[model samples]
Target: EPEALDPRLRAPDLVDRELSVGLPDAATRRALLERLLADVPRAGDVDLGAVAARTPGFVVADLAAVRREAAVSAALRGAGSDPSEQVRQSDLLDAVGSVRPISLSGGGTLGSGGLTLDDVGDMTEVKAALTEAVLWPLRHPDSFARLGVDAPRGVLLYGPPGGGKTFLLRALAGSGDLNVFAVKGAELLDKYVGESERAVRELFRRAGEAAPALIFLDEVDALAPRRGGSTDAGVADRVVAALLTELDGATPLREVVVVGATNRPELIDPAMLRPGRLERLVFVPPPDAAARADILRAAGRDVPLADDVDLDALASELDGYSAADCAALLREAALTAMRESLDAGEVTAAHLATARRAVRASLDPAQVAELEAYARRRSDG
Candidate 1:
């Protein structure tokens, strides 16, 4: 069983001492494959070790299915051939491709979208912090254990909307090989009583099974608002309680981390910001001049540009622009150029200036002040 067994069945009156069987390692998987294919004809090119290396978190049953699929593939390929034509490496690889990992097939999704740290233009400090909070734990677990330190349990990224908080989360998820269970805060709320809490429990359970996984809750304020003053009839409070329990409950979460993003950090329950829950609160401020320049360059990488276009000046002018705002500016610039004439040679400075004038910055002075205050409070705390 991938999940917890019933407590009643574990009583002395019913079951004996329980034994846990974990997923097979590479050597174990190779040996199991050899055992299963002992009677089956396999091609010389077939390498069980390579196949085992590719299939992580695969159980014996999954290996059996792979063999069955491979056999079927071989039969289809070797029609009207000798009885010992054998299953080729290609057949086995195809079978592996067809078989999804149990974690993704059942609960969460795989975190391999080809988005790396490079995809995120700037935010060097934020990227370093995330790496320490997330990647360091998985990469240097021994160092942490030796130092008698517990890795950060959760990271909360708070910033203005369209500041690339979600994009940063996705990049962190894609930086390594891990399972990512992404859920919007609104999606977790249920109309029925207790169902919301149960959903939170199950989400954590799935994340545990897929250890080294990331549980990303976008717009976290929706799920965990300040308690006792909500208009939702205590639904958010219950969900927050459930979330707190899961974050620092009796059962330790090994190789699992929770990441949350919100535009309103002030609205989040203070309990969630405690040491054991979302210990690391990072303020994702709007992109600076260099970041804006990078965003503009990236957005205009393929678009034809005229000699009059000055990215540096444009970046300086768009001081408080978020990443999304920079993208929109570029898009608006292209549209402006297109509107000027059907044969407008390339995007020009005039077009970019018009776009810049049209699209206002999203973050106002008050919101910026609030974000700054929150950052100071976090540091003081």
Candidate 2:
């Protein structure tokens, strides 16, 4: 919250409220946000974290989402109105009643995991890029300062669906001391209007609190769908507003990394992908042939197979499958051997035949093509 640093962004009296809502105390956190929101002004833009100073650990994304719900209910009422019957506290209250705040990502996306460079395998280019972009800047903020360099607000991860986007993210989270906050795009969905807007605020708030935390939004297409494509009218607007404000203006403590992943990267709004917003976009392509053997060996090492089982042949047979798909196939094979108790003995080439025959590929050609097409439609990233 750079606004916190600037002092120029806060109001004179403060919002004069605390999250004091009580709904059977489902979660002490949400209940508190509800209470704080109760005293918030009925109108005007809200700076979530600023508003939530007293409600530490409250998920701002959930609050933003609830806010959207409030807006929608206000819209639905007086559809046939006398135009001057202005939206009121009652309307906001009604929206609140109808909606439920998200309970997931106690912080933000990626569930607050941490990591360093050692946990990953074979993502040489990616590790190099991350170290340069994420590590070097933090390690030498002074160097960056001398160079007149400002850190990136966020990074967008896009790629072939099974190319280890999630795995890479996990590895990033697993790496040392990087406070990871993972947000689920699906959690942005809400029953009412103001809710989504509030969730956006909550996301930034939590991210700020968990400074030096990496906020990972997996399948970000759902949270910040492309401007023209979003079905929810005000959602894109509020999400964009909150997200851009935080990323572009907020002074995140040195350790925070905001990463969003999407299979349909093209669907994330332009403001989100812009240079000043999520400035870095790293595309993870499906593993090339060179990576296939490594992926196979990693997934297959634990399986009890006959010594005669040809790993190279097995890898060859699974050509075109993504790392995830390859793992699924290996799992399917091993499971079959376990199930049939075949030969009451070692699983062999004959066992491999059974597994191959029994297992169907998780992703079909058409689906793969669709994912590929979506990747192609996005920018150089």
The local distance difference test score of each candidate is 0.82, 0.62
Quick one: best TM-score, which candidate?
Answer: 1
lDDT of 2 at 320: 65
For all candidates, the clash counts are 0, 54
Q: State which candidate has the highest lDDT.
A: 1
Runs off by more than 4 Å, candidate 1: 1-102, 106-114, 336-346
TM-score of 2: 0.64
lDDT of 1 by residue, 1-381 (tens): 524678788789888676766666668889999999999888789998888866655778888999999999888777787655789998998897677666567644534465666667777778788888887886678999999989889899988888888887777666544557888889889658888998899888777755667889889999999999888889999999999999995467878888899999988999998997998988888888988888788767767989988898889888778889998888898899889888877998888889988988887768888888889987996
Task: Write candidate 2's Cα lDDT for 1-73 as tens digits.
Answer: 2334445434457654435332122245455455646654454433333333322233555555556665566
- Tell me the deviation in Å of residue 172 in model 1: 2.3
